[model samples]
Each structure stands twice: as C-alpha cells, then as structure tokens.
Target: MLTGIVEIVPGVSLLKGRLSSHETTQMLQAEGLAESDLIPGKYEGILLLKAGAEVHFQDYNQEVLRALTAPNVAANTAASGQHAEGCTLRRPRYFAGDWTGLPCLLEKEGLLATYDVILSAETVYNLDSQRHLLKCIKQGLRPKVGQAWIAAKSYYFGVGGGTASFIQLVDRDGTFEVKAVDVIDDGASNKREILLLSFKA
Candidate 1:
C-alpha cells in the first residue's frame, strides 16, 4: 500500500487499501488524522509510467493512494499534460510528447499507434513533429522503441513560411521524446543539424 497526501498543503488525507471501503477509509484516517468535514474526493491525479507495469491509485479525501504492487509507474495516470509525480519539478511540467501519445496509453494500457513509414532524406532540413507524423505515414514506420527516423513540417515566421527538421521515434518501451532538431536555414536549406539529443532507451 502506498500512502501520501493528495493535497498536503491543502490539508487533505488520501488513502487506499486491498480491503473493503470501510477499511480503506479507516486506513486513510489513521494515516492523516481527518479532523475536518471528511469531505469525499476522488483521486484526481495519475502517473504516466512506461508500459507493461501494474499500478493502482485512488483519491480519497485529499490524499492519493498508489498501490505499490509493481515497479512500473508508467501506466497508472489520472491526468493529462505534465504531472507532478516525481519528488522534484516543484509544480510538475507538461510535456508535448506526452500530450501526443499518453492518453491512448491510459485508455488501452499500451500504445495506440499507427504506422506510416514514408521516410524522406529531406527530413534533415525540416524537423516539425507533424513532419515526423507524415514521415511515419510514408515509411510505414510504426514507431516502435529505439529505431530512429526523420520528419518534416512547416514553421511559420509571422507572414512567411519556414521549414523545420526533427527526428522523432518511440523507444521500445513506447516512451516518445524528441531525438534531434534542425531548424531550417533558408540559406543552408535544412543543412546538417547538430545532435540535439538522442533520448535514452
């Protein structure tokens, strides 16, 4: 059984258990000393861990219940965008990659991805996420973990149009983060880009 305040600064005591509802509530009260109105609240937050791990969380009072049943923290999530799940990040930051693919994971317990592997060497000059999506379509790339590919899309600069280059891929575990970047240079025509990063597998 994992225990913590759902909103400690807000004065809430959350709890969870493998027992009956009465037992779960009692366990929470014992942990937090509920002296207030004992208002009912649902576990409103979730942690987006990698796939293939089991986890359970519940919102009771203001405390969050995380069942420490497994090692994966990637599957059990209750919110969208960036989360404040880790011990750091103060107010939790929302990540763009998560917004694109994580919701489906929450619904299906795994990746809900499509494959389109129409890859382009022009990808080096244009690094937009949309371009990556298009390249996925062209190359029949299913976005499995570890394999790398390039994507192209347009970036608008005020009244003008600009192109970008981005390397996009999902690691084997289905965690998708940007692999590299090459902002288009009209003079250079999407020339070779520096290694922005290659996310860990």
Candidate 2:
C-alpha cells in the first residue's frame, strides 16, 4: 500500500500510485482489459494490481510470467520500501542586504511560530523582538548553522591561517553546528557582512 508521496519510476520520480489488486483490476477493466484478458502466465491467479504499487511490488500484474517466475527470474536492485516526495522538496536559501528585506520570506513560508537568530543582551527566549529571522533565510540569506555561520571574504588572516572566517550558527538540530555562506577577509569589520536574523519575542 502506498501511504505517502514520492514513488520512484524507471526514469524519474513518479507522482502516482499505491492501489491494491482489486483496484488495479478495476482500473484495467475500465481500460477495457477484461477478467479473461488476465490469463495464466507465471502468476497463479488473475492479475490484480494497485495504482501506486510498482511492477514487483505486489506481484499481481496478471502477466502470469511476472506473477509466478518474475521474482526468481528477475532481480530489482533499486532501493525498495522507500517513498519519494519528488518535487515537494523544500528550498532553504535566502538573502538580503538589510532587515527591510526579511519579513516577506517569513510571511510567505508561514514560519512565524517559533525559532530565532539575532543579537541582544538578554537570553533569546526572553527577548521582546520578533525580528523575522525566517524571512531573511527565504530572501536568499543562507545561514550557516551551528558553531558559526558567517559571510566574509578571502583575506589572509593573521599570517598563516586558513580562509577568512566570520559567521556562525548554533542550532542543535543534529545537522550542522555552523555553515558558511560567503567569506570576506574583513567583511564584518567593514560592515560588508551585515545581514541579521531573529525570531519573534
């Protein structure tokens, strides 16, 4: 039974499926394939398949050869039992030069419920500002989460150091401590990296 979205087709991710044997038979019947059209090939009985279910999924295609000897004769190496969401993937990248360009992204994604990323003297949970952080992320403001998420430039730091480091994010969502968007040698000092994001108070 196909419960969710995303079913992998031979070429691309298919957006349909998960019908049962009777359902497939009905569909085929509607398509003009009769009960007699379903003959004994390899599968023992008639062919009854589902919509979202796949070729070897339930093995009721009614193509006898498929039902009876398909399994032992054929081998499918594709990942099984996994549902794909296809084009339903989420886009998580946004940017803007100032705070004025933040709110739209937040409102569009409807993420004004929780979360925050800003600067202040008090603890985040106690702050009184809904700076609209999610908006910033939608406007192409990619935030490097975790230890650090910054936007700096390429400038030799001190003497013998790696690329210039500036931004950092501390979200403990188990994915990243930080992610770097852009790098500038002294971007932060010159206000070159001046994108700020925060949540509701």
What tens digits encode model 1's per-residue C-alpha lDDT throughout 94-133?
A: 2122123434433454323332222223223322334444
Number of backbone collisions per candidate, in order?
A: 28, 43
User: What TM-score number comes out for model 2?
Assistant: 0.18
Superposed Cα deviation of residue 125, candidate 2 (Å): 29
lDDT of each: 0.33, 0.30
Off by over 4 Å in 2: 1-97, 108-152, 155-165, 168-176, 179-201
lDDT of model number 1: 0.33
Clash count, candidate 2: 43
